[model samples]
Target: MHAPRATSNPFVGLHHADTPLLLPNAWDHASALAMAGQGFRAIGTTSLAVAAAVGLPDGASATRDETLRLALLLGSQQFLLSVDAENGFSEDPDEVAEFARQLAAVGAVGINLEDGMGAVDRHAAKIAAVKSAVPGLFVNARTDTYWLGEHDETETLSRLDVYQQAGADGVFVPGLASAREIGALVARLDVPLNILYSPVGPAVPHLADLGVSRISFGSFLYRRSLGAALEAVVEIREGRRPGGRAPTYEDIQSLGADPARHD
Candidate 1:
């Protein structure tokens, strides 16, 4: 296995400053390298994109191997890579911790673990196990309370408290768009608060003002890429060139070129 490239992980320091880390989610190595080329410091894998790409169900613990393979592929890229291992792909905390260790061995700097509204204690156990096994891996504990159902500030805070106590480096609450609630949560947490960026919700500047330390475009880029491809096909079918400029074939292929050759 390739050793982690960075002697000191910059992914952790990205959360310490005032500027919120704008993390773009990538589905594959090419997508990740493309984002890295555009100057993103770090990239996260979107479980939805990964599962859909492989014709598996997301949040069902079905894409464990695929997720690991993607992590192995992207972990050594120029940019820091964070794998979204939904529920750690297992109910057993030990298994989750082992998986995290494997990811760290492959050069991943972070892992995103979601609760999916399961038992809070169980999720916290997994977080503790992962941290115990790989303390350097940034464990961004995610709660699906808002995404999966109604927003309960009390329950959200309760869960986040548990996760923070369990040693989560960051807390992610996706589908949470309310500026007031976000600020409230930010004030309540000791660690960085990660909010998923919604086009219809608060803008990036507004989120930074709300004290959000990280903004994740979770699965948005992947979905938008699919939309763009479909629109391009339809435009061709209707006898018109696509509106936006696309990457040249050579440029796209260059994303997969051996990095050492460039050096």
Candidate 2:
């Protein structure tokens, strides 16, 4: 984080359309900074990772305070920041609008708002209100149709159309592991299309060719880190070596670790 200055919100709007924005979702300040150090121009905050860290339910509107605090902590980092604000944490359009303003003040250039399989009009209105409140903030409206991808994929496109009409700068569809579906969605959407990276699916270059404008690594890193730490501790208790690459003390110092949420 650094002092506020007048600069273009580089991550805002459809700028990611050219080379594709590979956004890694950081749960805390250290992770955000680590990614920035790796030359990532933008980063996203994962609500699932943040909520789980604070023992709150993800996508349940239970982590509004925690989410805001995390934004305050990492908003001024070098990388452009976008937040995964689950359903705006409220159904009311006005309430969501006010939340958007707070996020903008905290220095987030973009936000990912999910529909949560809720009403089409309801999520669309939230997008509208947020754009009105924080016009500079890029709104990547997400639809869970293909995410949960239970039925036909065409239904996902229909949902995105509503979000586009409501003024989303981009759209995200997770759980769309199929190349055919991804290509079709990219061809149809007027705005940038973001797809979550799948380890078992197409690689990054392949995805880029399919016309994906952004690829987000959601809570994958956070969850994997947790799993590694737990495994290491168990191995140590049993007098066995750990199973992964452990960072040196110097690296930890570089990350500026505290007792909570060390990167």
**Top-scoring candidate (TM-score):** 1
Locate the minimum summed-lDDT window of 10 residues in model 1: 1-10
Candidate 2 lDDT, 1-263, residue by residue in tens: 01212236677433445566789999988888777778888889999899999898898999999989989988876668899999999999999989989999998888889998989999999999998888778888998986655746778989999999998888889888889888888888888888898889899999988888889999988988899989999999999988778767787577765424543
Q: What TM-score would you give candidate 2 relative to the actual structure?
A: 0.91
lDDT of 2: 0.84
TM-score of each: 0.96, 0.91
Q: Positional deviation of 53 in candidate 1, in angstroms?
A: 1.1
Alpha-carbon RMSD to native, per candidate: 4.0, 5.2
Compose the digit string of candidate 1's lDDT tens values, residues 1-263: 11122326688888767678999999988899999888998999999999999999999999999999999998887789999999999999999999999999999999999999999999999999998999889999999989995899999999999999998989999999999999899888888899999999999999988888889999999999999999999999999989887999999989889988766
lDDT, candidate 1, residue 201?
97
- State which candidate has the highest lDDT: 1
